[model samples]
Target: MIMVTGASGALGSLIAAKLAASGREVVAGTRRPTGSARRVDFDAPDSLAEAFGGVDVLVAVSAGFAEDDVVIARHRAVVEAAANAGVRQVVYTSLTGAGEHMSIAPAHRATERLLAAAPFAVTVLRNGLYAELLSQAAEQAVATGVLTLPLGGGKVAAAAREDLAEAAARVAVEADAQVDNAHRGRVYELVGSEALGGEDLASALSAEHGKEIAYAPLSLGDFRAALTAAGLPPFQVAHTVSVFANVNAGFMGGTESDLPGLLAGAPRRAIDVL
Candidate 1:
């Protein structure tokens, strides 16, 4: 049995569906398992014993937005439980280049460190940015003909979240003679084959929307101001803008990874990933 955390989410649902389709028993882990019949509550320790009791592997799909201590503590507790459960394989979905000193890297890095100490075999999928993450901005840009952001013409090797989910399921559900050994311990930088800058993004938006959606570069200060005006906390705006700045410094791209190799021969196109 494979226990998949965050089963109610988009990524988790995809992972569960794929594994079940392969005739694998998926013990989905969620805060509340009411929606998914194969689910288990992650926050309830008593529930874990039964869920992890006979599971062969654990696919820990992280819940993003740990902008508070409570969230961090809860996340850490789950990691500890996985270790104590004595599961054979532990697979985690993480951001690409997490903890490499970028804005959100610290949190991801901290988790990586904790998970690394686990006695069980582990696989970390350091997935890159998601294309859908930019859809709202792209749509707004299309409406205004201005692709406005703090990005200063740097590249990002982003892939779709669903694609990453599929890869995660493939790793967690299949083990022993079925597991892909190349993914273990090694952080696969699951990058999209194409790397594009802010300007390139604007161009793509313009082409897709059939309008002159041009890039509007802004400094971190201005970006924060814009985000604040748009109703986000100052610190969150700062962190978000800071990440975009890191992208400008070429922090989001990687040349080679086993992700592409793993997804090869599938019925999906890399473009469809968006």
Candidate 2:
């Protein structure tokens, strides 16, 4: 049996639905149990063993959008439970290699280390930032006629969330079928084919709305101040600033990706999505 943790989440739900449609014996692991879905709360480590029981392949969606320590602890608990449950293989959705300098990278790297030390075979899907997220900037630009961000000249290799979910499902299904262990112990850099910058977002918005949208660059300090003024928590403010800092330093885009190779067709155009 294949089980997907965080199955009620945006990404995990897509994976579970795809796997089930493929005629596989799939289990949904969520915090709230409904129907046959198992309660797999990362915060409640004791409940994980039973949640993972009898599952040959486990898809561990990266959790915790809080502080670094909190995220690491949640991942550690899931790893330990998966080990004790005798899961044969684990597929983890992690941050992309290009996002190594982002504040969120540490927790994902910590999770990768934990999974490596476990007994089961592992596949790391280093997914890129979602195009859906980047579209938010475009939406804001359409309203104000100005796309403003701390990403100076840097571009993000953003992939569609649906594409990333599909890739994860494919890897888990192969692992469940024991398909030569080809993906086992492998790390796939699932970034997008096209890299988008602030100007790119402005252009997309201009075309979509038939208006002139301009790109306005904001300094990191100014961005942080705005976020703080909006009453964001300390951890969230820090994480958001770090993401902008990394992007501004040209650390969030890459030339190659394993995304298309794993998918059934070409990746969706990020600009079109925006």
Candidate 3:
């Protein structure tokens, strides 16, 4: 059986659904039992053990970003449970530039390490930034006619969440015979074909919405204040600001083969998604 953890999440839910629709024996793992999914919580080891029984392939999605330590601990719990259950392989949804000192990098890097050292074969799918953010930015721009963020001249090679979910589904179903053994214990950076800067993003939004959208680059302090004013928690504000900083430092942009290879076609452009 193939198990997709974090089934309630945006990406995980899609992956589980896709795998199920494709006729795979899918077990959706969530914190609550909804429909066909089994209830499994990271803080609850018994739940994990119960949910993981008889599972062959495991799709381990990252925990919620409520806290870094909490996320890492939850990921570790999943790794331990997978190891104990004798899962054959694990496909992890990690972040791009996970070891590059970004805001959420440490937890992802640590989780990758834990998965790598596990008895099972591990595939680390380092997903790029989501284009859904750009979609949201477009909506905000429609209201204000300005796309404002702390990202300076840097760019993000982002793909839609659905694209990543499709990749995860394939990873879950493809067997060792179909996939090369060399891909095991390797990291695949999933990214879009092209990088998008703020101006480029604004242009896309303007074209899509038929509005005079403008890109407003803010100071880091200003960006944090904006997020704070928007009622984001202190930790989230910090995390978001740090992400923008990394974007400025060029950590979020890359042209990689894994994403297009997984899709068997070019990923949907950010503007199209917007």
Error of 3 at 194 (Å): 1.1
lDDT of each: 0.70, 0.90, 0.82
Q: Which scores better on lDDT, 2 or 3?
A: 2
Model number with the top TM-score: 2
* Two-way lDDT contest, 1 vs 2, winner: 2
lDDT of 3 by residue, 2-72 (tens): 99888988999899889988776888898887787888899887667778889888998888676888888
lDDT of 1 by residue, 1-274 (tens): 7878888887888888888776787667776667545545545655665566776788878765547454456557767776677777778787676326566676677777777887877888887777666667766887889877666767766677767877887777556235466656766667677676778888876776677878887677787778899998755776677677777777775545556666634323333343
lDDT of 2 by residue, 1-274 (tens): 9999999999999999999987889999999979999999999999999899999999999894889999999999999999999999999999999888889999999999999999999999999888887667777888899998788999988899889989999998889888768899999999889888898888878988899999999999999999999999999999989988888898876748999989999998888877
Estimate the lDDT of model 1: 0.70
Model 3 lowest lDDT segment of ten: 175-184
Query: How many clashes in each candidate?
Result: 1, 0, 0
Candidate 1: where are CA atoms >4 Å away? Answer: 35-47, 68-72, 176-182, 233-235, 266-274
Q: After superposition, how far is residue 29 of candidate 3 from its true place, in Å?
A: 0.7
Q: What lDDT score goes with residue 128 in model 2?
A: 85
Q: List the residue pairs that clash in candidate 2.
A: none
Candidate 2's C-alpha runs over 4 A off are none
Ranking according to TM-score, highest score first: 2, 3, 1
